[model samples]
Structures are given as C-alpha cells and as structure tokens.
Target: MNIAKHMETIFLASVVIVGATSMASAAVARIGHAAPEPKVYAVAVEGAPMAVVTVSAKRLSAAEKAAL
Candidate 1:
C-alpha cells in the first residue's frame, strides 16, 4: 500500500478497462449489417443555353464541397 504500488495498480486497472472497452466497441456493426449503395437522382430543366453534360462514376472532392 505504498504510493508507488498504489499508482501502478491504478495504471494497470485503467489499461485493462480501456482494452476491454475497445474490444467490445470493435465487435459492434452499424444498423446490425452492412450499408446499401447510395443513389443519386438527377433532373434537367429548360434553361437559357446549356448543353447536355454526361458524367460517370459521380464523386465530389473536398474542395468542391467547400465551394458550396
């Protein structure tokens, strides 16, 4: 029950508690299963003078999001 032994016991107990909590968290899955693919919907409206623009494999970068 010296100061050094008391501090060592507290450190060991904290390590064990943190390790067990991490293991338990890793075993959980969101929504109890894998997520489905996200769908993107598009609609075109009549405008001044804009031609059709076709794009495949749609994706947005961080810079594009910041510009919005």
Candidate 2:
C-alpha cells in the first residue's frame, strides 16, 4: 500500500468519527432533561479584630493609560 493513500484513509476515517461524535452529542443536548437546582445555604462566622492595614500607591498618569 502507498503511504499517501494510507494517510488519506486515516484522515477521512477521523473526520467521519469526529462528525458523528459531535452530531450525537448535539442531539443529546437538544433532548436534555431537567437537572435539580443546587441547594444553597448561608454560612455565618464570628469576625475577629483585624490589624489596621495601610496601602500607598501613586495614581496612574494619562500617558500610562494610553500606553496600556
């Protein structure tokens, strides 16, 4: 068998496989069933005193914004 012909066959087979797989998955999505909504609950925790934090930064200039 020729190498080129073998590769062509393999590529065509892969294309068919991918197309069928995608179509099947799409059909399944169209027939989707209702999924139960997740139950959520609020959790509370005691707050502890946090140490004072300080942040220092210079405002960006108009030139800096334009460059970005």
Candidate 3:
C-alpha cells in the first residue's frame, strides 16, 4: 500500500511538470506569432547610373510616410 501511494505521488508530480512545461511552450509560441514582421529596406547610391531599389509590400504609417 505504501509503495502504491509513492508511485501515485510520482505519477501526479510528473503530470503536473509536463503540463506546466507544455503551457509555457504554448505561450511562447503565441507571443512569437503575435510579433510584427521584419521590415525590408532597399538601398541605392544617390547618383549611381545602375541604381535600382525594391520596397517591401508593408504599408507605412502616416508619420513614417511623411518622414520619407
């Protein structure tokens, strides 16, 4: 009976630890998913004959547009 109780305690502790770890991983994944995408920039020299630039599809905010 004593051994059975010990085994039960061990099993419950393992379950709790696994559940907590899974919850933490899921929260981290959700935070990563909610993050903003990285911005892409195109660079060019001012007076270069072969200068060409491509911009990302992301829309700029009003302040950002005004600054550009």
What TM-scores do the predictions have? 0.45, 0.49, 0.42
Tens digits of per-residue lDDT for model 3, 1-68: 58776998989999999999999999999877677798869667788789569886989899999999
Candidate 3 lDDT for residue 23: 99
Q: Candidate 1 residues 1-68, lDDT tens each?
A: 58776998899999999999987777775436678898868556778566678787758799998998
Residues 8-63 of candidate 2 have per-residue lDDT tens digits of 88999999999999999989988987677988685555695555788898888999
Task: Say which prediction, candidate 1 or candidate 3, comes out ahead on lDDT.
Answer: 3
Off by over 4 Å in 2: 1-4, 43-68
Worst 10 residues of 2 by lDDT: 42-51
The TM-score measured for candidate 2 stands at 0.49
Give residue 48's lDDT in candidate 1 (0 to 100).
50
Candidate 1 positional error at 34, Å: 1.6
Clashing pairs in 3: none
Q: For residue 46, give model 1's deviation from the true position in Å.
A: 14
